[model samples]
Target: MPIRIDRFENGPNDVLDLKAGTQPHIVLTFLATNNEQAFTQTEIHEATDIPRGSVGVVLSRLEDRGLVRHHGRYWAIGDDERLASYAAQQAASSASTTDDYYGESDE
Candidate 1:
């Protein structure tokens, strides 16, 4: 099949660059899931199984982008508006996949 170059060109490219299983994605999802509390870099590394050095680097990058915030040794999800929309999109996508897999209920 030929690649649709026109479609690619027409689509917006400013979308968040997060992709499943990426270091940033893994870290963001973990923090977003446990947004009520902050964690240290070591904790994030242990929980996400990413290298400790990589975790710090990823967090620094995310902080620079305003996608995450930190205070002292603790880090938490950021308040960026894009994050809320991204989370909603993720939830909707998950729901759609689940419905497709198990069939939607009539209730």
Candidate 2:
């Protein structure tokens, strides 16, 4: 008999990268957009489409950077002001790394 897995997972040797808060930043932004609520790792994994292992690692790095916090068994976004500043910096970095494909004009 063959085993059936539910959630899709990356290979064991796949590289894990949060892209210096880019991944988690995007995830947090989406979660915040939906609503500010604590979610378990499994929820985050499914919501973000990130491998379970990578989700844990990314969450750990985010916690270390004070971008997120663990309360009880769930995790939540950190301070709003702090998150805003951090996300701004990450966006700036992303912008500098890639040109604006949208052709946005400065006011």
Candidate 3:
């Protein structure tokens, strides 16, 4: 894996990166996109293709941070305002990375 050293010489106003492809991030994204619904650990594991144990652990961690909510066996994205900004930044980063990789075409 290549290390990306982000230098913010202009002071700290940059968007907070959720570190793409991480288990927690993946689980959060899945719940966010399906905000209208909730799922159990098994369902989330199947949907996100993450290990069942990992899914449970990640969900617990996210809940501790108030990023997700649960009722019995079901889990859903929490109403954290920070999530809005995080999602926006993540989307922007993904787009920029994709554009950089594919590059612009004159045609």
Best by lDDT: 1
What candidate 3 gets wrong by more than 4 Å, as runs, is: 1-17, 84-107
Clashes of each: 0, 0, 0
Tens digits of per-residue lDDT, candidate 1, 1-107, equal 56489967897664445788899999998887676789999999999999988998899878978989999999998988887766666566656776767776789
lDDT of 1: 0.83
The predicted structure with the larger TM-score, 2 or 3, is 3
lDDT per model, in order?
0.83, 0.68, 0.79
TM-scores for all predictions: 0.65, 0.53, 0.63
Would you give me the overall lDDT of model 2? Answer: 0.68
The stretch of ten residues in a row with the least summed lDDT in candidate 3 is 8-17
| Model 1 Cα shift for residue 73 (angstroms) | 0.3
**1-107, model 3: which lDDT tens digit per residue?**
54445645544553333577988889988777676789999999999999988888888888877899999999988878877566566566666876767768789
Candidate 3 residue 47 C-alpha distance from true site, Å: 0.5
Write candidate 2's Cα lDDT for 1-107 as tens digits.
54345323544433344453576765665444434578898888888887788778778877777667788778877776867665566566566767867577787
Span of ten consecutive residues with least summed lDDT in model 1: 11-20
Model 1: what TM-score?
0.65
In model 3, what is the error at residue 78, expressed in angstroms?
Answer: 0.5
For this target, which candidate reaches the highest TM-score against the unseen true structure? 1
